[model samples]
Target: MGQHEFSEGVEVSHSQYGRGCILDMIASQTGGIDDARVLFYLSGEEVTVPTYSLAPASEVTSVESTRGTLGTTVTIDDGFYTITVEPDGEGTGYNLSLQAGNAILDQAELSSDKLF
Candidate 1:
């Protein structure tokens, strides 16, 4: 995925998943999104999408869109992997990452169209 321009507090709308909020971003130590990923909270679940399939959310009304939640750094451990969720600003957007040491597992992002 290329460089994506988005704030830390903005709602993202997907063409398939409807409306969701950007939870967080995982960039390289150099702040590069080469293997970066984002966590999105949509449909009552946290989904990981690639940064390439991202776009800003439009100001349109839709039934699938639900008001996203905002919060501070939330961490969850499933024994094997440790997960963290940090929301952006007081609105939505934040950063979500999954990695083991210096290796990146995956990266996700938000957008204004379908992800499938």
Candidate 2:
């Protein structure tokens, strides 16, 4: 892909890292695309990678959500990332989680109103 500028919070994909969200970006001191880099969060870890090696997260061309007896599961994968919402064991609320492959980046319990 051609060199392009990216800002914080943008989701990007790398050939080696899969999908990640940009946490910060450092401009090249020499104003060279080869030197510019970005700090991104991937699989629960923060990593810095060269901008040239990344591209805007491959478009999420297909998304699927299924509701079953167990819970609701949503898959939005450009070959990465799955989000899940399930009833809290207590039956009081729903638990939401964001996952990339096997890494759970965030999980939270939400009340009915918050979930809907």
Candidate 3:
């Protein structure tokens, strides 16, 4: 059995877009591709992006965090959601916005070994 490590509300950064936060992660066992659904709020607007497009912030700058101060940005896939990171002086309370996207109707579909 393979141990899968997944996370929610993770920090991320993007190329075309600036910085953002991760709302959720969807992984495919066959391709080993992890898709991180992200939300970014910019100019009073919310946008959603994917994980593959996100780049680490720590790679851009140095910061402190229990998680190694790693950050990433997700590119907007849809125009419904936005991305924003609230930086408290104490470093807490980080919220990211995610626009609605394709829905996962059946849980069984995720477990199926067949890719298509």
Candidate 4:
């Protein structure tokens, strides 16, 4: 997949899974190796899945209308990633959020970005 495939505001579906909305896409160094990561909400749970395992957004046919929002920005030793909340703008703070595993290696903020 190209870098543009990880763009914000994209919807996708997985094989054997119902559907999921793309929250944040980031690249980071893991154990001296670079890896692409994609964070998304699945079945009301926050899941951080590898970008390589994700199918193209167009191939997903069971996509839902639910959208995601950028909640916060997090930075670690190797790289940085963002926190995302589902269902768009809903409250003053994020009740649920997800971040890349590599991005949570250090202290970071939750809900750094405002919901639009």
Each prediction's Cα lDDT score? 0.49, 0.67, 0.45, 0.44
Badly placed stretches (over 4 Å) of model 3 are: 1-6, 29-31, 43-50, 62-116
Ranking by TM-score: 2, 4, 3, 1
Tens-digit lDDT string for candidate 3 (1-116): 11233256655556666556666766678765457666654433345554567665444433223332433323333332333333322333343444333432222111122335
Clashes in model 2: which pairs? none
Worst 10 residues of 3 by lDDT: 104-113
Please identify model 2 stretches exceeding 4 Å from their true place: 1-5, 33-42, 60-76, 82-116
- Between candidates 2 and 4, name the one with more favorable TM-score: 2
RMSD of 1: 19.2
87: Cα error in model 4, Å: 35
For 1-116, candidate 2 gives per-residue lDDT tens digits of 45554777777777676777877767667865442234444556677787777778755435778786656656565646677777665656677887877999898878765655
After superposition, candidate 1 runs with Cα above 4 Å error? 1-4, 28-31, 34-42, 59-116
Candidate 1: deviation at residue 17, Å?
Answer: 1.7
Expressed as tens digits, the lDDT of each residue in 14-114 for candidate 4 is 54343456666555655421233333444554456666556665563322234335444222211112343342244344433434433432332234355
Alpha-carbon TM-score of each model against the true structure: 0.36, 0.46, 0.37, 0.38
lDDT for model 3, please.
0.45
Model 1 lDDT tens row, 1-116: 12555544555655455456666665667876532233444357666665555555553321221234564565543222344455554453556655533455665533223245
| Candidate 3 similarity to native, TM-score | 0.37
